[model samples]
Target: MKNEFKGLIVQGDKKFSIKNAKTDYTGGYNKEKAKDALVNSKIEIDHLQEKLYASGTYSLLIIFQAMDAAGKDSAIEHVMSGLNPQGCQVFSFKVPTSEEYEHDFLWRHYKALPERGRIGIHNRSHYENVLVCKVHPEYILSENIPGFTDIKKINKDFWKQRYQSIRNFEEHLTANGTVILKFFLNVSKDEQKQRFLDRIEDPTKNWKFSSGDIKERALWDDYMKAYEDAINETSTADSPWHIIPADKKWFARLAISEIIEDKLKSLNIKFPVLDELEQSKLAETKNILLTE
Candidate 1:
């Protein structure tokens, strides 16, 4: 595993630093290069997953966070396309259900965690408690916490508390043999506008483009601030966030593949060795084949 944090911005004010950590992949969106990287990454991840499965130890959780039209879905699809379906699961978090709202915020997230030897992907995760909740406090009415007062102060305190809770939760998971990788797809405003326009122009994609999307776009600056704050507060050594430059989809996929592959490689997984009896039987089979 690469000990050096690849493409991470570790400096003053993680929130502000993350916003400025953008890169233009010199290779641009080359499908061939992207696909090759994806294939290699999947192979490495699969090998590690197999070893973990055999050992009955360690789970992997990958979280993807991005603004609307930031290629989160596409990145996951392309980067992990070659992985075995049985060894992986994907969870897309959405508006909380009545039952989910009844429990604490983290409870719902905890339930979806990956089991040992498996890889789990979260499309948008518990961070919503801070991101969307901070942007639109009206969303919290669904939570139905009694005597909710001072919405501004309450929201601020809630996010800070949530960040701490998330850190503790990740620590617990790590202690129990889980590796967590969090990613925030960083897309520029110009690129986002182009994507939105593409959605409007293409009939098949029109359904995905809701009028509410524009409303959200209007609050881009606010959301950006929220995202920066969330990433800064919660990004810890146990579960650090990778701020992926997503203006170019192919490059974004490539970068993600590299990160995942490196992490898997660090696990140092290998196929189980055969016993003496098994080795002798294999030698006999090889001799028979040679004679034939």
Candidate 2:
């Protein structure tokens, strides 16, 4: 697992460049290789999840962000399938309700954070403040931050402030025993178009497609710029973003699994220790069982 696919990102250097950051990773999606990686990652993550649960030392928060048809749900399902259900929870965020709109932007997100010794996965997260809100500035009006009515100033500072806020929030979580792993599934526009077309053609998947998806795709460049800015600004050491190559489903799954496995391994978690007295008691119980 260590050497199977290190630095696998095909255009990773360019995409990660500070000067001209890009969000496309279509070149690294090898279906056969990805399957092997995913298999190994599943074993590692499962073992780590058990240790994390037993030791009760830390919690994990995984965030996934992607455009429509970028396979966020499928990624979560496949990558997390091996984990103990009792030790993990998944939250899918949607458009805010009236009640949600009444509170601060992070309030609803804060409510879904994982408890001690568990993993929480967010399909979309508080990043909406910078991504979706950047695209649709009117959404900021719903946040109701004081003096935010001035569109000009709000546009200028909203995303920068939100980026700082997210950094601070994640740092606070880390200080309080949380390990956050964020992934921005980078899908190509052509792949997305193919996926949308598949959804339209298939009866079972038709429900997932909507006219709004096309409308959203029309603003593709705007969203890409917003994404790049958000990632560059908010990706700190405490809560770094893994820009996953997601043009292919299998490769996307493998990258996600690898990132998760790496995060869990970094915690150095181990199975709970039993004292000598407890070990002796367990031996005695084993003897009794043999006699019976």
Give each model's whole-structure lDDT.
Answer: 0.80, 0.82
Residue-level lDDT of model 2, residues 178-241, one tens digit each, is 9988888888888899999999999999999999999999999889888887877776767777
TM-score of each: 0.86, 0.89
* Residue ranges of candidate 2 with Cα displaced over 4 Å: 1-29, 276-292
Candidate 1: regions farther than 4 A off = 1-5, 9-16, 26-32, 146-155, 272-292
Least accurate stretch of 10 residues (summed lDDT) in model 1? Answer: 4-13
- Candidate 1: which pairs clash? none
Residue 45's lDDT in candidate 2: 91
Error of 1 at 249 (Å): 0.3
Candidate 1 residue-wise lDDT, 1-292, digit = tens = 3333354533323444655667444244476867776677677766767776766577889999899999999998988887778878999998899899998888888999999888899999988888888888777767767756446546567667778887888889989988988888889888999999999999999987889888999999999888888888887766778877788887788778778877777777666788999999999999999999
